[model samples]
Target: MAKDFNENDRLIILNLYRTHGDHYTNFCEEFGYNPKCAREIIRHAIKSNGVELNHGEWSEEEVKKLKKVVRSLMKKLQLQSYDGIPWSRVSQKLHRSDVQCRQKFFSKSTLFKMIPKNQIDGWNEKLDIAKFIALLKKLNFPDYNMIDWDYIKEKFSSNYFNILLRKWREMRIRIPNHQHLSLYEIVDHLYKTRVLKLFGDDPEKMKEIDDFINT
Candidate 1:
């Protein structure tokens, strides 16, 4: 018999969908569940909660709308601001940790269901498409010793880093452009990427990353 999932588990599954997408295949890979079971949950959500995945088997107009929503939602997660929401700042405004804000503001099912097909005019249209790419760059190719986890913990608090640490675990993102990077040499790269967003981007800060990685 399949065990019933708790609300938290359900939220994790839902977030997996939101973070990844509605395709049952990604769900199975990330959550270690059969794709059929994952798809069934999605179907159940649609029936009971009005949640839908905007699957491809729809009318052209409907499919276009769904695809638009799918693209936007993926974009939203990577944003510093969306529709002027300053989603990254929502944690400070709500007086919660990122993880807490995620749980309270975005119920997993809600996150999955709300991916907008037709971008409403008010939401952030000018959102940066470069942040995650930059993030991955910072992770994979540390050029600057600009990362500082202690400062990140101080500025954003432990909960912030903790939440991201969970993501780091889930995604297993690591220093990729390492011609010389060992595991300990990699911590500085991790620090710069996760900790000091403001100061890390300067090209001058990269000297330490070069020195540390080369040493």
Candidate 2:
């Protein structure tokens, strides 16, 4: 359990909060507490009128304003019509952290529904896993330690790449005698069962990805 805050701690909280605003990571580090604990303390302070905190849940009006700002930025940046929303701008306008903006935008209720269907499908996690498995098979189960992490990061976005590494490790442990199986067999086994149940079975995606090894 987190320790109860005392008078000195409350003073420190108000001071750091005034200095840091919503930059909770740095605030928590300096105050020797986790983000959850820091938020609780800050909220309590605000309740007691110790400090003013404007940041809160994004209202419907805020979401509408955000969409407008995003549309404007897309035009100025010359980003593709279907490109991902720029969370940095959203964070600045909303006075929230980039992670907070991203989490709010991509939460299940919003992400898949808000973005273009094709774009969402294109960034599917299974595709990355399928691609990784194909590479592993061709490399003959090469020592993961020998693999260059930088090169792997280049191949996939940071978030999906982490997922790729995790799933690949899990597959290596769960699927015994993997060396004896062809890439297609391994992919098929993973797809047919719930073990790695990829969300959608887009025929074109499967065909494009399954014709691997040579790539």
Candidate 3:
């Protein structure tokens, strides 16, 4: 006896799928439901509210087009803010409210999906790695005496600086003998570790890292 999905559950399914494709696996993982059950909810949405899925909510085609527009705008330097995202322009192009556009684009689910796919195309991971390694060496690793986070933020985009640091810390914890490693060695170690593969294999991931070592 499967439980019936309420409107909220259906909306959750729709939102997750619209904002993060293949969300059925996540729904199953989060809710202890099997993939079949997770998928049934989406099927139910299509059958019961076909118009809503196609019109009110973003259809698959619409999301794809929106992603392209967002990508194009992000590449134009003049259109970006400090965070390097231009949500208002994205909203106008998508014909959706800015708030909604922002929520959908930066939502936890959306970012989770985007990172591995290389869909969020603006950040140069190479520069980020170079700057991060330089800072870590400058501070002499584990010493906070002269570390100024603001300077690091300036070196990397404010939106992603913290994430980069956190990633570095995570990498440090995973690998041993890091204390004696040079900056290049540390970067190489990070490349070998899971840190570099943060974006797993996704068929849609269009971008490849063209490593541009700044220093």
**Tens-place lDDT digits, model 3, residues 1-215:** 12576666666666766666665557555755566765776654443323233326766676776667766776776543224566666665654655566556554444445454444356666545644654455445444445566666766554476356545655665677877766556655665443335533532321222222132
- lDDT string, candidate 1, 33-74, tens digits: 666666665544432333443222335454344335434654
Better of 1 and 3 by lDDT: 3
Ranking by lDDT: 2, 3, 1
Question: Where does model 1 exceed 4 Å of error?
Answer: 1-3, 47-215
lDDT (Cα, tens digit) per residue for candidate 2, span 1-215? 23576657666766777877777547676657676776776764453334353356788876666666666877888854323457767666665555565555545454445555654455656566766655554455345456655655666555555445446546754777887875556655665542234524566755655564355
Where does model 3 exceed 4 Å of error? 1-55, 78-82, 117-215
Off by over 4 Å in 2: 1-12, 15-55, 81-86, 116-209, 212-215
Q: Could you tell which candidate, 2 or 3, scores higher by lDDT? A: 2
Error of 2 at 89 (Å): 2.8
Order of quality (TM-score): 2, 3, 1
For residue 20, model 3's alpha carbon misses the true position, in angstroms, by 38
Root-mean-square deviation of candidate 3: 13.9
Models, CA RMSD each? 15.5, 10.7, 13.9
Backbone clash pairs for candidate 1 read 69-116, 69-117, 83-123, 83-124, 140-176, 143-206, 144-206, 145-209, 147-191, 147-192
